[model samples]
Target: MALIFLYIHVLCLWLCSSTYNAQNVFFQPSFLVTRGPSVTALLYGNSSNIILILQTTSPSNVTGSFDPPSCVPEETRWVLTSELIAKTTVQVKLRLNRSLRLCGNNETDTDCCVNPLCVRETLQVSACEGNNSQASLIVQVKVYARLVSGNMVFDNKTIIQNQVYRPLGECPCDLTFKTCDLWCCCDEDCSTEDFQLFKYHCLPGPFGGQFPDPEYQCSVQSSQNSPDWFPFLCVISPPGNNPYLGLFYQGNKIAPKPGMSFGASVSSPPTLLDAYIEGSPILTLKDQYFTIPRTLNGYCVTSAPVAFLKNFDVKCVTPLQACPTEPPLQTIPEDLRAVVKNGVGGNAVVDVTDQLATELNDFITSSESFGSSAVVCENVPLALDYNFYWKENGISGITLTRTLGTVTLNGNVSLTTRYSAKFLSGDITSKPNSGNPGYQVGRPVIGGILNTSIGNDSLLIERSPMHLWKPVNCGLCSHADVRPVLFGENSTSGCLLPVSQLNLTQCGLLRDTVNSLQDGLVEASLVAINGHPNAVTMADWLNISYVTLNSSGVGDSNSSCSNIPAHLQIYVWTLVTGFVDEIPQKDIKAVEISYSLSSWKLECGGGDPVCIDPAETQRLPVTSSVTFIDIPLNTGPPKNRYQINFTEYDCNRNDICWPELAFPFTRFYTGEPYSQALAKGIILVFFFIVASVLGTPWRQIRQIWSTI
Candidate 1:
């Protein structure tokens, strides 16, 4: 009985060992097979260490028989075999027979492939289902045209679909096979040698495939894990909203709905029926429309049409082919030609004439020809300003102003084009008012010669004498321009007067010129508002109230005692009569001019006893500036008043009653007060308790607590 029991135990152990080894032989969780359009393979297996070697065979040489009624050609026969190896993993590869005639030249031939370009064959492995550890698999092989990377080739024959539809569809950009595409690192056919060259050069995928989740791609070891393997473990995850699932399934396809939309909306150019409406395209002389030139994806496009009544300013830098000389119209840009053609006709209301075209051409060629030999004249258009005058009846006229500038050889030019459409009216040429009623800031101040005669009579006409001066040449002074002064603006202007000689006569003339310049500006009156067309009013006119001229001597005969105006400073006052809607209303009230004269002490040069002609020129710096001060207007009388009364204690008798008495805190207290009473009390109590508590012994504190 003991021997039989021992034999039963041994049988059970043997069966358990066999089951463990069988699980290891059939532990294949996944498999991969490479496929193509013409030649494809359909593989099914669950066991590991199984290799497949596929080879093509002719119809006569094939071992299988073809059924004529089914039209199955023997050239589509393929044999799949396995290699006996010691390794645990198996590798499958295809071996092509180049010498075999697999298909006929045309479709009419007997026992020929239906598709000349595409040939398909199937190899059934009936013996693959040997035991429970091995699964039945079918092998299919085919031959067809292969595509190259970056090049597109279209075949009309019916071929097997080689599309790989993942979350992202098949790489439309990766059209090549067995080669590495530039900036395409995700290509599977690329070897290690190809990847080493373009790994870092991979461009961002169109669907953001280049930037994938790092956790999925990175190989994380068990030792490198943090306190929590996933930091967002507690976070609420979103549902999978995959878009490709709607089109593809597990090895199957689902056609998308025809009504589904994708990408941006397409906008069509406006036609003649939509003329004068909002967003209507600009019209041209022909049936076409005006389009703006643009560049997109390294290609030039002229389809970006412009809209009527839409003002825009665009600037672009482009290369220019330059030379010393060219034809008048050759150098002209296409934009200029479009402007000239569209200057009339269509919506244009102006009367067309032959002279108009002539005038336009003449204006374009008005500049000198680029014919200079000393300087290479690479003239390019700088700016194009288009002003379209429009009314209710469409555009009345169009004016184009083109600015051109020369550039260096092999250089780029920047062109700015501006288009503006303005409404036309009878009063369009009239000047805009400075303000509604009161004088506005930055507006030109009204200034002119004032007549002081009581009766209407002509006075002695005086020379419109030069007053202010500005620098013309190096350190040389010239008469300043008569520019209108603006309100609320402080300005400074000056010049240098160079004197070649410093004799008594020249000194006298210099003194006279300086005095005359200062005197003329001193008497001028400036009005705060614009001039009236009728009678004159002097109520708001500003006159000089104070004048100061600083100098040591005034005798011009003494050459040594020379005094000339060096700097003049003007101060103007304005009255602000309150604000209307937060804007201040101001008017000029008064003007004051002050001058500083610098005297030159002449010394004899080169041991000369008396003053002689100096070889060096002398320069006197003259400067002038204006400053404005605003004073508020007094609208009413004083609001408060005080009357003096006598008291019993006078300031002389009682020191406390003094007008300039010292502050109470300064006289009564000599140092800082106890302002922080709460903080001081807390500090004092804390220190007292610490001293008392620390003085007591531990045994005494225990006894006290027991007594309590």
Candidate 2:
């Protein structure tokens, strides 16, 4: 067997635990850039008293712009931040209801009635430092149109391979020549320039103009291949481990040593998240440590506005350094903390409870096929089953408390790992089966009775029946497309990819939520797997030495864990209050308390249920929520080092490694016409056969037949 050295970290929750960008934002309703403010709140604009209500208009046709809050009052205020460089141009934040809105009282006056902010001009506004010159505070109301690439969405923060940030060329709205080049929608009057990909970069536009491009670099972490019993690496540490008593793998169910613990929740996660997006952040992300329910000791995490609430608060500090490993953890911005404590205003907990549950069910139910080559448990395919819920924390300090359930570890496991008994030397087989599956290699997984208490939410999954599709008549291809189809030269079908729009992640899984069927996953199928278990064939063909394989295969196994990964990897997502010792290396790390970036809360007149009205009534207080997408990243990027000159991304520089996404979709190859090609082949074969038969003289044939 191959000697393999593993450096896997075992998280102890109590002992351990476990634990971007905006681009083409407008066409995408939930683009990250559109979700949060790029700059921190400039509490004091250049001019404070000269309160100028930026009467900006947000509409569907606007490109490079964020979608405005729905049904909001016609006006919204803008802010300038000290964090940003001096003199930044500001854009309008309001989406205009052209037909319903009345900008002013003059119905007949076109200028007063129509939406004021123009899309053509840059939204960038100069500082309003209450300057003597009116020019300092001058704001432009330009008309713009949408010139978008529905398929070509770009992200500035997340860099992806082959997804280089190409410079976007603007149509150059030539006001001088109303008759310009690119097709576009202009103001009621053709006074502004046409809108094209412009200079609003998430990173410094190395290529010039702003590259509001979006990309993700999915570092293909190690992945087990052709797993025999499904893989599980216990963080013998806290948050990462789920308590399980016995592992039912390949016929053998191995129990953990007495007193030793194992098995984690194959369901809900321990940590939860809540983020506030869509404008300048009222809440800033910071480092924080909170106590776990079981122990007085707590784990520290860099918060996403609210990974921990006041419920877990201890002594607090400021400007958290590094990832939390110290004591007396600091807190996130205080104002944001207050909001979460209050919960009566805009959404406090961006809850994604339902989504996480759905994700959990999907992962738990999903399975991988078994193969003999996979001798080690790490060699098998594994799925993470983590579920969580967010609602009232049961405590008044927090508006909503995120109660996490168990985190499930599931995958397809073989019944009994088989090998050619011929090669089994009495010496190797001399050792007991160890009563463990994949024991020939290192013992990858063990189960034990957990000491912790089990609640109603605890999920105990035993064994699931393994069903492999076989051909009954014509071939397995004749079977329904219900199960994942394999791909190959003889393959009848694989996953079929549907046409899809560009996603915020850019290169990672392109899941189409509205129509789950057409997701990019449907475009490919797991036709074949790579990696070999280094087996040597000897002169005695029957006897082969099974050498262990080193390093994990190249695949998206880690990423598939994300509920997303890469720019923001989800090392561990929990639904319950679990423990984690260390965090993987990534920019944004998060744990949820009572929120999901996807959570929605309606704020009309505070949390007053009475302010709500009938949908039909104008007086019906607007059901409002900052339209947000709970991406793996829920909070805004850190403000400390925003740049004038953007740095190139790892993917752009080809400096990072990426995992291969198991063929998630079906594919079709279009080539030579079958009928015509077959006819040609037949003709060639027919001529050759005829020539051969004729080549033999009749007399020689007769003689040969007689001899026979």
Candidate 3:
């Protein structure tokens, strides 16, 4: 059992060894520090051993020392087992023993020192073994300083590329070390030359040595291919952190215009004009101050009553001026009144003279009695003047005439006559004459002595005869004829002679001549008559001449005369009297005339024809003793008549004509009396009153009964 145990133990040991050897190994604090400030290192091994070291290309101040001489071994190693696997991670703390300081000169510290020194460092290890081996386990370290001078302290460990670090010691005030001069230091006492060298000379710093100068001159080329210089620079630092900087230069110091910059210079974006970027303000620097140039021009615009530049830079222009207004238009006045003309009594009679004569003539002739009277004659001797007499009858049957003298008449008595007469010549005559018995009486004287004693009174006789006759006379008869006569007598012959006067006695002969003369006189004296009322008045004898001449023929000495007594048996006549006598005469009796009268006719008899009295009946005498009877006529009866004489008549001599006795007829009738008409009206009124009174009460009763 002991021998078997021993062999088993040996096998188990071998297996453990082999398994541990196969496990993976890892390192912590992969970067080793050869600088200030120590870092802890860890080893992750699963049953495997791990070892590490720190290396650097930087030189140490101590010369002739081991490459990574173990002053305090800058790396650590570890091994792990199954029983302790949970605690397999081991920490190798690197407490830097910074008591040792770097000497500026390499001659005094030619041996490797045993103290820690700060330097910029890196940490690395050999390739890891077993399972998945890693060769990139490295760490870099940077160091700050308490004191630094001209010489730079390099790390003993190797560093990787692109690592950044600060120097490990305090910087000297006036030292001019190349790498140290280029390093950035927090201390103000450090020379700025080093910071400036990195700032301006480096690739992308603002003030590197290769950067363009602040005073550098540039030309803005108008090339289509080139991007806009100002806008491109604006995009670079849009907040205007360095607005003065133009494109492709440092410290150009350009600025945007007031009210033009973006964000900073202007709280808002500038108002855009015309194009998106063409009118933007260009930034420039003058005397280290920012300014903007108003360089671009743009389009013009109109704003109604004013024209102004818009979409363009109008830095100092006003925008509210107006154009002039046109003058007020002239107008003409309009006509207002209507046309008018003068009128006759407001009548529009443009010409008045044409109708004056006719109007005057009509006015004069339209009087009530124009040309009415045939003649104007007074009471005069019928022989001295022509008598124009009008019969007292109606207008239809009337005559006119003229007579010659008081004793003998021969004149025209025509239907219309005012006869004109003129005395021409005449012979005188006596009524009778006696002759003598002279010679026979002497012979008988002897025997007659006895008879002479018987008789013989001296006959004393005066025979002076004078004849008077009418020159012209119109016969007062129905025939229209006139005669002019001359009468004479011879005593010895004892014969009466008659002779006709010489005159034209036709109806119109003398009248025509006289009227012609009168018309001529009147016409000739019109102006004088108008001036003087009594100027040469023409006599009305022309009317008489017309009557005589129109009724008689021309008389001559040899013309036969009428066989009538002179101055005692002649009369004037007219034909119209005969014409009237020839008309049929109606003998109207007094009773017939009275009965035919219309005044006695009944006007009303309750709508009936009037009754008439018989022609032969006499009116009854109406006396005080007679009593009137009350007749009860029938309703709607035919008319009746009654006549009674109320006045007395006279049966007188022939010279006194009296009216015949006739009855006075009265039209009378009885109707429904006033009492009856009143009774009927009252009955109608009573019926209406009863209707009004009973109807309302009945309606009320009906309403009351209906409600029950």
Candidate 4:
């Protein structure tokens, strides 16, 4: 029993030893594949004394192909078949052996595997084929793997350590494929030598079949730093508003509306209008108005009521030819003589001669007979005078003494005739020599004649019953009322109306006649002339026809006062004689004479009542004066008085005839004393006293001489 028991024990020990070896060989973790030193092991073992063998799965023997092959000897051996390990799971550890052989049949040769480089790898291995090690557990080893470090083979495919590899085929991680520095892609084919790596965001799968999401695909070349690809539109939204759409060419934003037309030479890129179709039915190039689409936004056509771009033009013209001209003056006709009969009133016959006559004839023939005619009288050298005359007839058998003046006519048959010149004396019978007498005398005066009968015939004279031409202090008969009468010869018979009716013509005939009647007087008194020294009464000098009228007395006798009528007549006669003797010198046809009369009141009384008794009555004495003078008919009166008379003398005997008369008296004072006797004595005594005084001086000298 003892021997048998000992045999069982020996047998049990051998069986248990074999069981331990088998478990350690098949299931022991041996090689480590780690990224760092012992931090994470790809394979871990519980035994410390296990041997590690590393190999590379890569076929290349380059330095970076895989890990270097290494052997780690231990007290115990950890065994693994090559079939159970992947070549990609092996790692190799290698060492530099300058004197050793790395691939040869000699194991102890000096230059074999001495470089201390090892590889470990985890790889995928193929099954062992026909003549390979099949008995005795012949394992096939693969040094290259997909992932490896040194010469170790890992059962798992995880890389336990960081390792370098020689990239094979077309490795994307190769340095030859690296894009760095300033290198750029120029082609769209990313697989070609000139292809560039592109970065693209995953977008909706539409254009180029790209994916959308977090994954990015490499397709076309990136537009960044590219010359051909440009940012066609860039719109930057405002803070709160829509983004601005920016269109760019060659990286610059193109203007939306360009001023200049396209296709024209420009220095910059085209505008936005050239690059885009903006809003709704965008304007296209096919429209009828789109002849020049390049100028689209440049000039847009608005709606109706279209405004033109600018302005238009204008023009003008003119004409050609010319015009015409005109003419001159003339002369006036000369004058000729023209005589018109009864052309004007009075002796106012106008003689039109020369130019005046021609004008007058033209005027007369063109005008009516009664209407006015321009009878032009030129250079009429003859002096024209209008003369007036009247006749006087009052006393019976009285003859008038008249002086006839000589007359001559230069043209036509003119004659001189003497009308009867009469004295317009007041009375000389009452006081034969009175100094002044109030009397107005006229000849052949019709309206103012005195009615009387001589023998069996009746006579009418231009005398009043009082023998005064007008009353004393008669306002109407004053100088204002006197006017001259004028006469003219009959054309055929050369006969004139009587001087009383000489004023019967159109030129104031009625006016002159009325004036003469109201203001004229006729004188018919006989003047008595005496040849005696003593004073004579009117009764003493009787029935005288003529007297020697003298202005002063002769031989120491004082001159006696003459009657006014007789003295005026004598003065007129003297003038007539002188005029007749000087007839050749006289040029006028007649002469005009004017006369006047005035009177004043007188009272004769003293203040003694008894010496000149109240019962004794005294008579008042009144005196008057008349004067006659000759003046040119045209000369008007210088001063006017109470009464006046006018008379005209006709030098032509061809009209109106009257007999010559001597001086005649017209008025006399009826009751008045003849104080000439007392007056003469007083005048003689006054002259004697004056003579004695003058002679006294001379006589005294003579007396003294005699006494001596």
| Per-residue lDDT of candidate 2, residues 55-134 (tens digit) | 34333464744333322222333443233233432232333322222233334644222432222322322222243222
Candidate 4 per-residue lDDT, tens place, 428-454, comes to 122112111111123211112234444
Question: Of the candidates shown, which would achieve the greatest TM-score relative to the real structure?
Answer: 1
Per-model C-alpha lDDT, please? 0.46, 0.25, 0.27, 0.25
Best by lDDT: 1
Candidate 3: stretches off by over 4 Å: 1-21, 28-37, 46-86, 99-708
lDDT sort, best first: 1, 3, 2, 4
Q: What's the ranking of the predictions by TM-score, best on top?
A: 1, 3, 2, 4
Off-target runs (Cα >4 Å) in candidate 4 are 1-21, 25-46, 57-708
- The residue ranges of model 2 lying beyond 4 angstroms of the native Cα positions read 1-135, 141-143, 148-708
Q: What residue runs in model 1 are displaced by over 4 Å at the alpha carbon?
A: 1-434, 448-484, 502-504, 512-526, 530-553, 557-563, 592-596, 600-615, 643-708
TM-score of each: 0.32, 0.14, 0.16, 0.12
Instruction: Output the worst ten-in-a-row residue range by lDDT, candidate 3.
Output: 588-597
Better of 1 and 2 by lDDT: 1
User: How many clashes does the backbone of model 1 have?
Assistant: 3
Candidate 4, position 501, lDDT:
16
